[model samples]
Target: MYEHSSTHPADPTTPADHPAAPDGNALTRQSPFRRTVLRRVLPAVAAAGIGVAGFAGFAHGSEGGRAAAATALSRDTAPGSALTARAASVRQAAAADFPTWGTRWVVHASADVNSPAVGLINKSAAGQDRITADYQVDTGHQVCEGSACSTFMAHLTGPVTGFLTVVAVDIPQDRLPGVPVHGGGQPQPGGSRQEMLDRAATWLTADNGSQVPYSQAKVWKDGYRQDCSGYASMALGLPTPGTNTVGLATDRSITRPVSLGELKPGDLLIDAAGDNNNRHVVIFEKWNNDAHSSYTAYEQRGGHGTDHRTLTYGLPGGDAEFKPYRPVKFGD
Candidate 1:
């Protein structure tokens, strides 16, 4: 998972929130621009480079495994070989240590908001070089100043919160609620971006409040807190763990990064600045024009704890661009 504490560059007004691009093109009026749909494709080659299942118990196991281990101890821990060995050991140890559904464990460090937001530690993924402990904060009545506000704000409300879950555990910006944004607080069946977005919108209506998960849909100013990628992950109903990446729309914390061309409907587009980041997550309605025309990016903004609008934005502008990273789809 990516860290949120790193400094982000200044944002160049986006078409999603702003009406036009820096080039004087009326982004709000354009139609069918180049649209990228991010989907849960297979794990990238780099993901495979890291071990996926179980801890390392092969040290005293099979014949071939033992010889490989001996070679590893002798050699300077070869690339793939050392990684595999280390992953295996981690898997075994983790399995024995934490007997749970998921092999991953979420460890937290004690943090004080008044103090700085650094110096915490954690155990990194097996065979990996770093540790992976996250910070845990109990939201009290006090309100935080900026993005750290989530820790001070109340549980989020609105259609977005219902289909919500913390995608990035490593750098926990907000205490992600384990509720579905659309499917009545439970995990809904996966489907196309339109399907998910439609479901969420439908549930967002005042009449459907009874059917959705949240107690009410009123904008709770502090009810929910999310950056761009966090909003996208919640809207898509993707697992919290799978939404880890390094750069682009998600801040590398929400859903893991995928091929830019593989953009999906209801995908998140983000540009972060010093204190806050500009975010836009919408459904990729269709691909139109000769790849130069405007595309539809549907999103629900502002109406968070207030009456907001779910509008469509034109794409491929300063706020929108292709971000390619080692794709790691979120799931078990």
Candidate 2:
């Protein structure tokens, strides 16, 4: 069902994925000075589980204060609790299951046992800790601290839980998966047309063709976002974590606009306006017919994972925002 004819079927209506909103109420009333002071002191107080009365005085009007109090209380009641134990276990498991693409750590955090972890940040060689990629931890859902939830695709083995575990591993430069490497392990600016299509095909049936799940908030194990732009980046052999649709469309170094008639295999059709949820991109495969009214394309959509289907985007009476662009790497 991955391939389709020129009479393209109606695309499935998928909900837009959006990042989580900040909890504005958490620090709304605290002055800068008070907030700074609280940040330095709350961790120690929470760990020691002391000064409940004193901390309660500060909790009067701030959600952050109340949340801190609750944390302290939880720690006090169960020093070295099951969640803590599970964190240690998950950390080891993540390390043992480290991916070959690069060396990074998964720092896991959770709200409670009933809910899945809210944060899973990866620390990369640049000394920056971020949620650059996502994998399914278990049958349950996994979410970043301030991002939306995505479905579980790959499963994590061992004693896994709804708690956070941080695992760190080192990846050598030469082994960056999926992207072509040259000049002592540096990823090439772009890939060949066949290379792009081959890379795109992997996700269609990931893990020997099982299909990587669709996720705006998570990255596939290959270290690319599991969204349209990210998938396209993998095919193009761009750097890890990929660029946004706007970046792909507007970045002259990456791609240049082309007329609809100029599109070739491995080129792109990107809708580069609006926010992440509104914008979309697809990799051009080939025209479905000699008439040039429809073409087959590969895309990692919200509801569906990787798909190769016929589309009329940018053709007459089709979606106008989706303009064609050729990857600079092709040099065609």
Candidate 3:
């Protein structure tokens, strides 16, 4: 499903997993700015007795005032309210109750991932919306936010694949600063976050068994000897091939420093020792929860080609010496 122009690589530091936030949002919920996770099995807010009129007013008034509450309450429980049928459609993209690999789906956005959204961002805004968000799944229809509504349906439609849960977050609402949002909520196989994971899983579980060893300065498309940084580069679609663990931390185009609180899937975390040949780096996958204790990662190190592993949070004593970073660009 993915077309990697280059190849996937690995990390140089730890031999474990990375970090990701799982802020759940399907079509609608309250608390817009909190860390979010778009879920396949969404919570029914109808029980809350929130009204849609309030959200419609919020959407219109906030655009003019630009002071939409950091914690906007959910629009009332109207099927016709903001989190409409389309949002529900996106919420059901999972093959099962949660997101996982192999679930199938589609993505529809207002505009392409490269475009800018001035207004009327998404009708597909599902789950609890956040300014900075990322989307993932096993397979199913997934709708992410963009400048415009990519789907012509004016309704729910992002046929999923491999996983469920469409991430349709609207960014830059009036005075809100433009934060990092996922590409038009759809399956962009050319080079998308989900595609990157799909490609990595291919190697991890090939029919003939392709995933092999971890090689420093190695870029073999053949048997795929992905090192730690190499695996990171390939999965993220970076221009560099043999970028080592040190290069990942130092290279600007590849990544920029960020806080551990803002960590997302595909982000990076270098150890306290800093970037270098011997020091290490790992691609953040996802955290267990808001506690930031345990997490998953993707990398190739310790002679392993490439793998999805788990690790604990914190410094040597498990307190977190994370020199966290985010990818500047994955693919166009």
Candidate 4:
């Protein structure tokens, strides 16, 4: 449900098909449920072969010490020193997958989309003693159609056992509600990223026809939603032509498809929801490479007039991260 505050105006960017709260945790696998089938039980049976593993000691002993006079360095040695250390700690926590690895199950949104882990959790293992990694479905943004559009493909390595398959869940177009398409013409305020994102979020909330109501914004001549994408579209003066069974892109200005490798800050990000086809949309803000993988973003959560927060996810939400999907190029 959407929350309200007087400080923010009505937003227009919320996608029409924004998803509801996710059903459950992503650890448990949907298939492989049958007790009698042979191939269905293969994975659970094979996992029994792993032995009880135990972690050993760390070698912190100084091998060859040459005593010398020492001067301790101060914490102020660098600007933002403390802040950097805190950031490092946050990253370290996100990276560790030990406690919840084996007990978790993989919950696929559809045959196409797989879950991106929201957080790590622990569960007792029935098949093997080893901890299994927990994974969950992604529920922010709009893509091709709806259902399964947000499906995922994950990469797994040793000590972090998870998924390593390549199939996409397909959200069909029919179930999705269309975006109320409108194009703001030239001469209005343009190029403000946050403003645009706010609008998109508002519009999306409105589309769901849910119980909550969103905030409103007043441009020169129109009453806008205070969500993210709505603001982007309003700034660009793109028309609210009508909703598509699939979600709408930020700019009608886009002609050529953009490759994921070339995404820019202001470009629009789309997502597919299970059963609904193209359920939501959000904008890309920035990218950081120092992390293990790329993250896509969205501005609000819980639908309707909700407070704004930054939400990041696996690169492009699917296998598209591996190849390329014609992304809308900036200044194009």
Candidate 5:
């Protein structure tokens, strides 16, 4: 299961507060200018050897060596092996592109283009190497270049059953987006409150503008568990596969307890004391009334995948286990 248990099961009925699901056709419709740009850019991306097959020899080796490597990559169909080979290829590409840079390059990946990058490859020796390698797979796409070349997007497949566009980028440790430029403060993960909400909104219509299904046992294409905590982690810019409900509640580096009256957009209401099947968390969006008796929140529940609805989980007459927590990423 996705580490969350909801009192409400997945239901077909849409709540009054739930935003209508997007129209699939309308979502796919692109402006002529966008289409023209894609046509011009895709060829360049392919020529740059950005795909899995291309990456096999993208950075190193002679023609024959490249062909052999590509063939070996093709033969190794296992997801874990493929991800390792791909990560190695990315590392090699980074090394070749920026040879003077040290081995301290950390690679962040996001399956969603709008979402913040999660730490896929850490600068420290103790990073998650092949974290979601065995999950699912999706084809690769070039999401950045030139001015925005800090990140590259690709795809993966697995148990979670969704296409993963692995957005991997080789960013220097000190140069990471949220890092303190003068090296005086702790590095914060990237994303403003609006950006975080925007990231959470992506999953609502992730599948061609449709809600990503819930899965406690699997992760969504974005590599987040399709559960309350996983969704919260994605919103907060935490590492992929996400921290558990307990971790979200207790980890000072990630979040700290706050009074209900202090709740703001992007804060969490977490019930972390119970087992996975009983634990849950929700993203507090805003109070429905100044009275603070009811508020709107984003949740990834058992039956309904991603939902934005009015909830009183932590209010006076609400579920007592739920507590307000301000994500530490927001800073004091």
Candidate 6:
């Protein structure tokens, strides 16, 4: 549903792990200095606009009943305008192709680190643009200052191995083992940010041995293999296809940007160097006594694996020079 966008300015001067924001509405600190929550609300509109249940054989049925020939999602189009409707159906199909929230997909890409799959998806969406001016390709979740489609896909590199599909917010019980379960099952109920965060914590089973595996599901038999954005994506249930450090915290539908001192326990630390390779993201564990003196975080690194490290402010190594953001639940 997205490429990449410059939602944040890149500041690669530092490369160190650091503490996270605290929990609750405004970042609460007991210090003498003033406290203020960075205030901004942006909702993540679905690029995954259509759902699978809506897909089917809707083409070639004549202008009377044909819907989308691509995915078969149901259409609301009235007859006598099938040509216009056919193009709209394709756009809907592209939207339906996305995975649900809290659900991850093992994307298969032909080029760059799993980026070809994204291009394929985007290309399909953009192809519909030939239908008319109203149609557009996979416009990423509204985080960029301009059109999400053109701006986000402008920068593309890497393979799809490390990718995790993020989708819209979902229920808490959906976080249970093998939830949003494939095939028919009783629909899982959703939860708030706390519930999703708690569920993500359960995946940190092999803290000592866990590595940031590209295909976490495949390699996860040994342990939960996760990358930084994958962990945050799961924790927030930001809807699939998922986003990278570049879009993680800034996705309008899921979170709002915040200053570092205003961070909460479930907030995120993102250092998006305007590029996915140079970018890194982490989840803030908590503030020690709300003093802002020291803190801990959960992250997936290259050699060390997924770790919960205690870090002080102003450390180096791509962890500093970052910004904090609050999940939607906390902000609402």
TM-score of each: 0.30, 0.47, 0.39, 0.30, 0.52, 0.39
lDDT of 2 by residue, 1-332 (tens): 21122222212123223221111001122235433333332222232222222221111112233212112101010001111222233334322233311111122121112121222222232333212221222212232111112222222232232222211111221111222111111123544676577667767665344566677667665556677777787677675456777788888999999999898999998776555545777899999999998899877765466777877777887767679999998887
Poorly placed runs, candidate 2 (over 4 Å): 1-187
lDDT per model vs. reference: 0.25, 0.45, 0.36, 0.27, 0.45, 0.34
List, residue by residue over 163-253, the lDDT tens digit for candidate 3.
1112332321211121112222222324445545543444453223545355554443321224555556545544323355556677786
> 1-332 in candidate 6: lDDT tens per residue?
00122322122222222111221011122222110111112232233432222211111111122111221111111111111222334324221111111111122111012122221222123222111111221212221111111101111112222111111111111111121111110001233444444544444442232333333222232111245565565455443223556566556666688776677677777766544434656678777655676667766554344566665432333336467777665644
TM-score, predicted candidate 5 vs. hidden true structure: 0.52
Cα lDDT of model 4 by residue, 3-37, tens digit: 11222112223333233222101222223321111
TM-score of 2: 0.47
Error of 1 at 90 (Å): 48
- Which has the better TM-score: candidate 1, or candidate 6? 6
Number of clashing pairs, model 5?
13
Error of 4 at 123 (Å): 70
lDDT score for candidate 2 against the true structure: 0.45
Going through the candidates in order, what is the number of backbone clashes in each? 43, 10, 81, 97, 13, 48
Which candidate would rank higher by TM-score, 2 or 6? 2
lDDT of 1 at 50: 17
| lDDT of the structure predicted as candidate 3 | 0.36
